[model samples]
Target chain A: MRSEEYLQKYHGVTKFLRILAQISFWLVVVLGAASLALGVATLFMSSDSFTFNFLDNIRLSMDGVLQFDLSLANITATTKKEIITTILFALSSFAIIYGLIISQLTSFLKTVENGMPFASANVKRLNMIGILFIVGSFIINTVYGLVANKIIHALGISTLSVNLQSDANMLFMGIIIIILAGIFRYGSYLQDEYDATI
Target chain B: MAIILRLDRMLADRKMQQNDLAEKVGISVVNLSNIKTGKVKAIRFSTLDAICRELKCQPGDILEYQAE
Candidate 1:
């Protein structure tokens, strides 16, 4: 593509990513503050119980012999600690993943804006995002699983269990991004060589 | 360390300014400056030919080799 078209494309993408990055930053700050507030609130209201309605339906069919439908028809009650922990876990996980991805994108777009998309800094940022996706997903899922189990036990719900599942798709995507970062690094080297050839 | 650019000396001997030579050679002043300062890694044959044509000098007059 011509340099003008290339720059225009990057300019538009950078503008969009800047907005996204700002939003993600605010969301992370708000979520962090909310988690802290919830912790403090829990300390004062330790004995209170909160009820949450299921947002989706759970369907079970066993060999056409029995079928059961569970939905908002189900409401679960839990203590203040359980509610706070669950909310904090979910919010923190979202904030962490969203913040990492957006921050990397912002930095990458800035490099492109400077007319150097194959910069060494962009490679590092891409690799950082890749590592965050892989490790963050694992940590978030594990924390959520542990928190859910603890909450279920605290609620005296003996029939329910929390199972931890690793996200293979996220891990695969992270690896691909890491590989792309390597390719970008190589591209940066080639660009340098080309520029040096006068 | 071996190849050296004598563009500045040649331009001085020809009594021509860098900008005039750059204009005649049809290259940016920045690129011509880089060539004169020996900051560039390699020179294109077309660029060398243009510079030689503009200065009315052989490539040997613009470039010299000295062992370091």
Candidate 2:
């Protein structure tokens, strides 16, 4: 395709995707907020009838007794409640971080749609996203894994095994994005110089 | 801006208006004005060649270097 054709096609796609990303970001925010509020409410409820458990990777259910799928056997009621609370907070934090990534993506796409792919703002946004992904994965995924493993070991639950592996792919992807951001900064410089030239 | 464009002095010496020089050089008056005012960071060799041909001078005559 011709350069103009490619640019036109890219712009059309960027505009459409930006709108989609905006909608998706808002949806994630609303869902994350509602889930967090519900979880917190159940955790704080003083009634004996309200029982909750975080089972598996995604252990949220709207059941009456809030019982988790994980048959956390040979643990006291207090310990079980504590574990549930930890999962609740961790998952909520994870959701918010995930939503943040999406929000950043929406903003990035908006800039692309504005026909300024080599803008300095894009470089900063990509750098921020790279940090968020790497740091968020470390804090929410790897850190949580370590804490969960310790809790499991201390509790002596051999049957239960939380995912102890960190996402190496995500870490590598973050590094790649950071590298891309640097390259983008160079591209922005060239673009500015080109525009300034007569 | 160590290399200064002496286009104004050249025009004055020739007793020619900027518009006449711009017309002879096949360039806009605004572009010639930019070159005159040192607003442009750099000038194209082709533009400088055209200006020199029209003004009957060498490149050195239109450009001068002064230490900062």
Give the per-residue lDDT of model 2 (tens digit) for A1-198. Answer: 964576678998888888888887788777777767866876875534324433323433322355434445445555555665566666677778778888888888887777767888888889988988787757766647754664566478689677655567778888999999999999999877755443
The alpha-carbon deviation from the true structure for residue B29 of candidate 2, after best TM-score superposition, in angstroms, is: 9.3
- Model 1: how far residue A102 lies from native, Å: 1.1
lDDT on C-alpha atoms for all candidate structures: 0.75, 0.74
The CAPRI class of candidate 2 is acceptable
Candidate 1 lDDT over A96-169, as tens digits, reads 67677877887787778777888878889999989987887687677767765655555567887777876677
Give the lDDT of residue A58 in candidate 1: 49
The lowest-lDDT stretch of 10 consecutive residues in candidate 1 chain A is A70-79
Off by over 4 Å in 1: A40-78
Model 2, residue A2: C-alpha shift (Å) = 6.7
